[model samples]
Target: MDPVDIGLWGVPLAILAGAIRVSTPFLFVSLGECLTERSGRINLGLEGTLIFGAMSGYAIAYETGSPFLGVAAAALAGVVFGLFHGWVCKFKGVNDIAIGIALMLLGTGLAFFFGKPYIQPVAPKLPSISLGGWSDVPQVQAALQVNVLFLFGAVLAVFLWWMFRATRVGLVIRVVGDSSDAARAMGLNADRVRLLSTAAGGAFAGIAGAYLSLYYPGSWNEGVSSGQGLMAVALVIFARWNPINCFWAALLFGGAGALGPALQSVGVSEGYYLFFAAPYVLTLGLLIATSSPERAMQGAPAELSITK
Candidate 1:
């Protein structure tokens, strides 16, 4: 069989691998957003947080020679960003969406400026678990090599889902998100709760950034996030703020994202670029289909700014 013909068969294999690899960032970011939105806060600035995390993670990993440290640094940075965003939005007349946009610009700017020095440096990559060892085909083996972060993300989704369903912390967040006045009546600090949730969400976005720079594409670049952070908000909505559903939705987006490159690799060049836009198109479609004000509002937290 011709090499290209063989490559055709590899398309599905490539997509399978790409889905696992690509979906990871989405999973982390969506999970984080899920937490934030669950608390009735919307953070549009996660995109900036994502870029800054990639830059900081790469620089730290390059300096420390430890990818794990880089991940830690990214998480810390995310926490700071999230906290600031939460604090500022707590003020009356301040819009969360506008603040989020500003933060996104700030994060992206800082990342590009600080990350310039690390562009040429090679940082250590995170390790992957070889699940395809049983397969004789190189494609199968490559496709089966899953990253540790992906597994962690999967576990996190389950944990978040369970937390929401069963935990005291989750209950408090839900209450604040549902009605701040009610939360205050219950003696809960609604503002503090949102601040913490937003911070946690930022940490997740940071980890997602670390995964991009230190694992998959494995480098510091301005385009590292490719808007995955921003898109995650939509993913969270598509999942109806359910963590487990976010996991599945992320994988679906990842597969859609991989379709173009996978097809191009198999010599299918016609309109392959469109495949790159598949995730975004799907997001729009999902929103259109599910976005009747009453329907969208049903699952949305009563205190959420978007729904309001």
Candidate 2:
């Protein structure tokens, strides 16, 4: 194929790869947030949790030479963060959003403080699957090197979707999220449910962080996250708190993120910054399209404040 034909053809292929690569973290974090939101709370501190998870995962992997161990440590850190968020929100007159922002700053500061030392080291990377083993082209092989986390995220999405629809625990979470008063009437421990859900959400966010440091970027750095944590909150909203939709929305965001680099590689350099902003632009557009001033006020949770 001619260079032009290759470029044209490769764009779509590259986009597909990028979508898978970039969407993995989004998938994890969004699913986590979906769980948290479904329980009638939001944790904005995922940004910090993500960065911290990256640092913890990278540090553990580097020290033990085990990527799996690193993932476990990262998840532990996420659980801790989630517990902290839950604990704080359980107090009287505490603002969850404000606490979320504070936790974000705290997580970022902690990551920067500890991540400085591990900046230069290399850690074990996650294994990839070669789905295109039959292909002869190097580009095809490279593109086919899929992350294991992506598959896990896919499976988790399907599992969560099923659980939410069919499981008793999922029913409890939905009950708590949709109406805490009803939960109280049913004699369910609303606070405990929220706490557990929040911690699980944080653990998933941490796993997303692990993917960033140990796989995609493959190193620990203060700047490892780059607002993916925050964008994920927006993604959860766009997904309508559905785990299955979170998967597709994450892939879309991932594709938008890859547009700039893909275009640049093909010598389309104009408006590079705009390309970089594609995900955020899409996010804003989707938010505007989905949000209704009247409907949101009527349908939004009484205790939840983001919509207000």
Candidate 3:
């Protein structure tokens, strides 16, 4: 292909590739947060959990020469963090949001502290499926190398969506989230439900971290996660706690993330940082548009302080 043809076709292909690469973390965290929020709780500590997961997953994978094991370790770490958060919030006076922020800080600090040595070494990267193998073009082949986590995230979204509508367990979680009192009347243990849901959410966040460190960027560093975890919370809100909506919203955020680099590659690199900020800006604007003083109060869980 000539330069012009490459620019026109290659750039779009790269953007799509970037979108897929960038969206995996959002997919995991957003869907995880969807579960947590649906259980009538929010865990913002996922930001910290994500970074820690990245660090731990990379470190373990490097040491063991097994990427899957690294992912498992990351999930375990996330579950530990989630359990801590759940335990703390179980107390009557503790604030889940405040705890989430604290956990975020804690998780970040822990990752940085432990990740210093591992930062220098490169670990094995996750394997990608090359669906574009039929194409002879190198660029097409590279663009078609899809991450396994992307497929996992998609399957998880569909499973959760179905579970929420059809499963008794899903019904129980929704009931707990919608009304603890109602759940209690139904003889369901609300605290236990929230605890398990939050922990599972954290595990998902860890898997996201694993994908970041062991796959895309393919290494561990303190700077690996730049607010993707927190942004995912906003994403879940924008998605209205729907796992299916979370999938589309994550892809949108992913596409927004690719805008800067895609523009730069085309020699239109002005306002690079602003392009990087596009996802956050879009997220903020969505939040403002969706939120109404009256309606927020009506739609938000009575226990949630954000709307109140």
**The best candidate in terms of lDDT:** 1
* lDDT preference between candidates 1 and 3, better one: 1
Against the true structure, whose TM-score is highest?
1
The Cα error of candidate 1 at residue 187, in Å, is 0.4
lDDT of 1 by residue, 31-58 (tens): 9999999999999999999999999998
Q: How accurate is candidate 1 locally (lDDT)?
A: 0.92
Worst lDDT window (10 residues) for model 1?
1-10
Superposition TM-score, candidate 3 onto the true structure: 0.94
- For 194-285, candidate 3 gives per-residue lDDT tens digits of 89998999999999999999998888888898799999988887787789989989988988888888878778777888898888898898
Q: How do the predictions measure up, each by TM-score?
A: 0.96, 0.94, 0.94
Misplaced by over 4 Å in model 1 are: 1-9
Candidate 2 residue runs with Cα over 4 Å from true position = 1-5, 294-303
- The Cα RMSD in angstroms, rounded to one decimal, for candidate 3 relative to the true structure is 2.0
Compared to the true structure, candidate 1 yields what TM-score? 0.96
Q: lDDT scores for all predictions? A: 0.92, 0.87, 0.88
